[model samples]
Target: MNPRITDHPAVPYERTRRVAFTFEGRTLHGYEGEPVATALHAAGVRVLSRSFKYHRPRGIGLTCGAPSCPNCQLTIDGQYGVPGCATPLRGGESVRRERAWPSADHDLFGVIDRFSPFIRAGFQFRLFRRSPRLAHLAERVMGLIAGGGREVTPDAIARAARPGLGERRTALAVVGAGVAGLAGALAAADAGLEVVLVDQGAEPGGALRAETAPVRTPDGGAAPGFALAAELAARAAAHPAIEVLTGSTALGWYEGGVLPVHTPSGVLTLRPARLLVATGDYDQPLLFPGNDRPGVMVAGAVQRLVNIDHVRPGSRAVVVTRDAYGYAVAAQLCAVGVEIAALVDPRPGERAGADAEASFPSGVAASGVPHLTGHRLREALGRRTVTGVVVEPQEGVDGRGRAVRLDCDVVVVSAGRRPAEELLLQRLYHGDITLDPGPGTALPDGVAVAGGAAGITDPAEALTTGADAGARLARWSPENPALPEISPYPLSPGQAGRPSSSGGTSE
Candidate 1:
């Protein structure tokens, strides 16, 4: 079934020019500028790769926009291990599944999952310990099975041999193009400082580009978050002192303010007097059996697919959340004509108190979707893909509760988020950085952080912090030191039960 969404209210879908690409020797069509993963997903190709050891089927789970997961890594255009989620679809690109024997859909090695118990960690060394010849053969076979991608093509080798490193300097460099980064860039530009704003996304809005709900503006009006992002992006583009670079990945920060950034064109060495890191956060996946199944996905990934890529994740979904963010995601799904089988919140208390109910979108309650409070996800049900889910009430809440089965093709998770602060942490401290440190705590000289990187998830707070950081790095003090006038949506009272301040994690 075609899962492309054409009737989203918040972000209207427009027919764009289509590009034809070859995947596994078969030609497929997708819109230009969309990611290869979404293209494949829209074309009904779910299984992207196989797990390293168990050879279990895997899809583009957490690799939606963030390249943190390896599930969607494919051999693209004869290059090995390219992230399909981040690579935009250009016409005529050759894509192939990696790490799967025969094909991702019908892998012969899938039987390894049935004997996973025998293949425990470091079992390879002991499995054929007695026979040296058997152990050597097993080692070679395992190496071939684990290796992904084919030999590098001659074209790829030629391109790699070309020297294309560039260098530039700026007064201030902001390392994200979200609301916070935009605000920071604008603030720095207003202070007459030359600024460079870099982001890895195809667009400049960051996660705001994925929001389908309308947010309250500063002037008592309401606008969609994507619209607000567009406005900020336009202003940044028009600003004389701000240079906005999209589709650019900031590799890392080195000694003496040296930063190497990778772009579609070439690598650029950037040296800035001061830096502001607003890289934001990643959606933390939940811990459960079958959570890594093909049809299960993080809430942020689903939002990005629906609102940004205009693709429906599935026909029916089971939403498992720990905070109000999940309900918002459910509302967006409902708005786009996806069925919500159930909304499960594992926290104890009455089934969504009055305050929590108020936080939910009116459509959610009006549609009569089931709400299971104090219910935890026991396991996601399905083997190759998610066919349903099993949920049970939290222990010690009341008398023993029986597990309830909810049939769904998709499972949306919004457990919580962990800060994406790799760049900042590398620059400041060698030790582990705290996930939820107070804003602006223990930051080193000539460096600042804002937004989720600084542990501020609220949009309003992120904007304010970003503006402050930009102004501070420029050493400009306005007469009126007040928060910026951009008022985005704030977390509701229902969010009080969000994951602990330490942040959420994946198993």
Candidate 2:
């Protein structure tokens, strides 16, 4: 038996209309205007979805603005591949879940379990070498099942939606409040169109709020991205034509420029004449054994936990990096009195920028993450939760890898960030965001890209870009600026490039 959706008098409720929805043919109830994830969470459905390759259990992350994570994919009515995070709920909607073939929880594909003894992480090449014919047969079977993955393609995702997206309007809607988004909104607003700017953070600033590293300003005044975000947010708020909806995210975008922004309050349908999407990216965590331990978190998630939420993800942590920005996060965290276990960079004396690398936290064990040239996280130690981490040499057998389990709960993985372009993928699918090598889709016809969307990686560039976006909306020529000398989305510390003479790199 499932708990019925009811408004407990013990807790004050918000909505008046009740909505009926279904998940995997299971009749469920939700509010008329609540996020599908929110309803699921409220109904004690913690395991909202699972991963593709491993078919691991996953649930809601901080927000449900995109389909990046595998947690929120379930079938609606007869629909599949719909991201429950980005998809909301409505009355009379039926959703059927596509659990793995046998079942969602206990899939027979556990045959991978039989091969674990012979194979380790990244062992496809090794397996092929041992038995070419057998390995070839297995590979063929894997491809037949897309390596045994789900059937949700990109097109199926675009056509999924909830309900109750009528009655509100926006001339121009910008779906991010970070540096790039702010710039885009200002530019669109100056063009004399009322704009709705939505962001998931409490402040309009996105990554800037979580980016704790110091940014070298033109005059040498050291300014962290957070500080620049603070200033830019104020200017954006002062704009009369721009409605700053902080703590709000474009839950999803629909036809006719209708974007429903969700906050703690509820979902608001903003009908924009144009959309300037600047939803920033997030550092992706690498998939390794025991990667889902409690202490293990994304570098960006830790930064937000420490700086914005005023909470530490762990008292002591290990940061695995091949990038300079990973060290930047380490320095910021150490300065905040958090104990550092080690700073493992997989790259060599890799120039982390003489000017910038000088800032990596001192007196800590900063070495390559790979100890024996190709070390990977082997097993996350703990019974109920994460108590330690064991990074071992790559390509080990069932028990061949050397393990170094550190006495720490938090393991911050700086894998790297991908553009939070899931929503943009919709346009790209509908042939909106073209595959153009330049300007990506003719700037979406009246939609101007600014900040990260326009490839602006610096806080300083964000300000200029945003101001320029506003000016461009008003028919001014503000040449799109170049990216910062330092990579804002740093994946490799040694991958630093000198900025163009103009002091940045633009697409």
Specify the highest-TM-score model's number: 1
Per-prediction TM-score, please? 0.88, 0.59
For model 1, what is the error of residue 192's alpha carbon versus the real structure, in angstroms, after optimal superposition? Answer: 1.0
Best by lDDT: 1
How high a TM-score does candidate 2 get?
0.59
Q: Quote the lDDT for 387 in model 2.
A: 75
Task: At residue 256, give the lDDT of candidate 1.
Answer: 74
Task: Write down the lDDT that model 1 would get.
Answer: 0.76
Q: At residue 263, what lDDT does model 1 achieve?
A: 76
Q: Specify the poorest-scoring 10-residue window by lDDT in model 1.
A: 487-496
- lDDT tens digits by residue: candidate 2, 1-507: 122323221112346476777765577777765456656655655455444544444454422222355555777654666566455566777664344555544555545544656656656667677888987787766654322344665655554433554557666677778877776676667678787788766567776765555555546676656666676688789999988887566766666666777654566777665566666555556676667634566666556545543344556777775555566666666656567776654443333333124445342325222222245566667632457877764453222445677777567776655456666666557654455554234444445555555445556665566555545544422243332211122121112222221211111
Clash counts for the predictions, in order: 0, 20
Residue 302, model 2: Cα distance from true site in angstroms: 0.3
